[model samples]
Target: MKPPPGGLTAYEAAGARYERQPYNRSGRSGLKLPAVSLGLWHNFGDDRPVATSRAILRKAFDLGVTHFDLANNYGVPYGSAEANFGTIFQQDFLRYRDELIVSTKAGYDMWPGPYGEWGSRKYVLASLEQSLKRMRLDYVDIFYSHRPDPDTPLEETMGALDHAVRSGKALYAGVSNYSPEQTAQAARIMRELGTPLLIHQPSYSMVNRHIEGGLLDTLEQEGMGCIVYSPLQQGLLTDRYLKGVPDDSRAATSRFLSEEQVNRELAGGLNKIAEQRGQSLAQMALSWALRDPRVTSVLIGASSTAQLEANVAMVDGPPFTDDELAAIDELTGPASSANR
Candidate 1:
């Protein structure tokens, strides 16, 4: 494999990397994850250069980020992200496999079949098999049922996750995008099955505060940790869009974020708060999401190593005070009151 743009021929992890960040336990479980985990939901597909993906992975691990999150349909062509990560793993990360907390989910549509999606036993188990093959790993540290299946019985879905751990296909089980009620039910079933749910992955940000309603309390009551994704609200919480959306920004290209949803005024107000706190908007957003101890980590995606470095630096920022929190809530409006 070719080296990344910097022209380095070999890879050696940083010696002081562990000292650079803190690792928090996942709920009451013994597993510990980096305060900031890297997600490969974007920029790891064949649409982007492989060298760039390799570079980001290297930079993340070097910065003491041991977790890499993914899903089956993450790439443009579907399954491309895992396939690409598998190739890079062979080249660089294979040796550090034991030191990594690799995770992937499978509750969304991936292939053209009745069993290709949802939370059925067949689909969930089969997707794990396909994911294992794509990532070239004997087992992932955590296997999640990406979303709850309304049509399928919750018992059957949770049963599949239990089987994944029993079969040695995954070390821990998790669920993402599950509501508080759904999470409690899933945790109950998983606990009954003897493979307790380890964590919950949700979309959370200064603007997207839905999870704050009851999910955090639910996780705490159930003794499960929370790992939030899209903590930057798809880049809206950052200074990138305070001026205007860039041509290459996700707001410009992806349907998930749009120019109409940019909210420059809201971002501007939040940026002021971030500046007062002596941090960038992106860093402040991350630190804010992690303010609650119930939150185990904030999962982030980066287009470049520099972006990754800047984000991981949030761990070093000072904690939010009551006045700062109130100011943030005031800027975010009523949705932020749900948690309080």
Candidate 2:
């Protein structure tokens, strides 16, 4: 609102730093997004300092990271993520809204009671209305059903998605945490409703490889793009754990990525592979996920601007060599939640 402090457009120096990165196509869609997108899943709640969050958001856009991801349940307290984004949107990014692709989802637990979470049309619609109010926007570029709700009817969920696009509330629809089979079904239904399913947001990294098991194939065939979250495997794939958890890492602050999850054995294996590649494990993890052409973008989270700068630079890092791939295979091996 106040000219975005230093202006939303990057200064000459910032533009120079961003000159080398290229945008990638999101499936067969006309959309061209940066290879790296930011996820506001954490540190965007009421508890975290807002100034730091706003700075990160401003820096992200200035450097060409246009797509920002969020969900109803992302905050330390529910609905805070959207509210936080809303604040930044009004404060700094309002004028540059056309240069942004803002997406928020509503399939996870956001409030108490039976109607609060899941894929029900009633719940989805209500959640979206609240999100719109919080985000201070008439529409979101992409809206996702956070996950499949087995108890709810698929038609009802798909119907809500269709209505969102048709009613001019959401430009595109996506499904997160859905199996390959489920994604196909939704795509089929959306086609009939005249709103093509646009993307699939899945948890994928070198450590989390569930999408490799036919999910990638389905998306390719359906003309839906894929954006993988936790591209650093909850920070395990990063060098942060190589020397054991630091007090500042996610392992210390959140239960989502526990220290026990990054046990010594796992960290050792990752460190060896990272060293061989001459890259930080975090950079290597991002490069690994981006290696797949089906992955239109990797959804990354950073607590600070410096961390984001290091994370996105993975785009400029080396591509995997045969020996590096072989070593990674021997270490991380096949994708299994139990193994690493």
Candidate 3:
């Protein structure tokens, strides 16, 4: 069979140093994560086509993006993304497992009934086991609670996280969508158990700035790292919609980021700033999130190989100038409105 377009054959001719992109320490841990990590969040779900999903993952890892982030409920049917990844991992990359950083999460709705979700011990530990079964892996590099379960006690969640790390099922533990207060609380609990809470994942972008409102400061104070999600604001921070949304674009078809909202209002100064840096709006948005040293990586989703290639290229560009920063700040105000 012919090699997949924009797939493994893109650089089959040369030896790879695998040092094109820089890596950062994941919190205070000895392991380092690449600046950009691929997320099996949206497009890896069952409803989407699978070949492109395979290509995106393969190309991403080939480009030195060793980290792959996943969660238990990542498919249209929930759990299908993990299953899909299992097939890919066993078929194409099992031998190189040591070279990869695999992560999965629980704490959201994975099953049904009372034991199905949240941060309870019964739920969190069971969910991680289910995830490992689906991914066909013995252990994940990191495991996280998908969200802060207000109903479940923080100690229960922290206990599950520490247990996962201690039992050799997960090497590290993290939390997502957590507030500064919750993070602080989790840290105290995890530190007492000797886990050291590796990182926090949050939805952050030039257009979505919720993490900036003290979350960054809190992370800095506590010495935790952050891996930001949706750095592109779905597809709003890309050239795909600058001239108006393309018919086949994510904005036009995606349920996560809507089309009407793009027509309503977007950070207007993005085009000018992106043009100044010779990058697409998406590239600029990724850079904006990574500009903060506290961020360990930007978790991005791409539906196709071309889009992934374009998004990854942003790392090679030059730094933003003072005037460029001022222009961007002036353009995208602090509304935190979704482009959708």
Q: Pick the candidate with the highest TM-score.
A: 1
Comparing 1 and 3 on TM-score, the stronger one: 1
Reference-based lDDT, residue 116, model 3: 98
**Could you estimate the TM-score for every candidate?**
0.96, 0.93, 0.92
Residue pairs clashing, model 3: 237-281, 237-282
Task: Show where candidate 2 strays beyond 4 Å.
Answer: 1-18
lDDT of 3 by residue, 226-332 (tens): 99988887767776676787788777776776767673245456877788789877888898889889899999988888888888888897898888877777776
Q: Give candidates' CA RMSD values in order.
A: 2.2, 2.6, 3.0
Give the clashing pairs for model 1. none
Clashes of each: 0, 1, 2
Question: Distance from true position, residue 105, model 2, in Å?
Answer: 0.3
Evaluation by lDDT, superior candidate among 1 and 2: 1
Instruction: Please list the C-alpha lDDT of all candidates, in the order they appear.
Output: 0.91, 0.84, 0.84
Kindly report which residue pairs in candidate 2 clash with one another.
1-91
Candidate 2 lDDT, 1-340, residue by residue in tens: 1344323442222455347556888888888778999999987888888878887887787677888998877887888889988977887777677878999999988888999999999999999899999899999999999999999988899999999999999999999999999999999999998888999999886666778888999999999999988888788777777788899888888778787777667667877777777777788888888887989999999889998888887877888888888777776666645422
lDDT of 1: 0.91
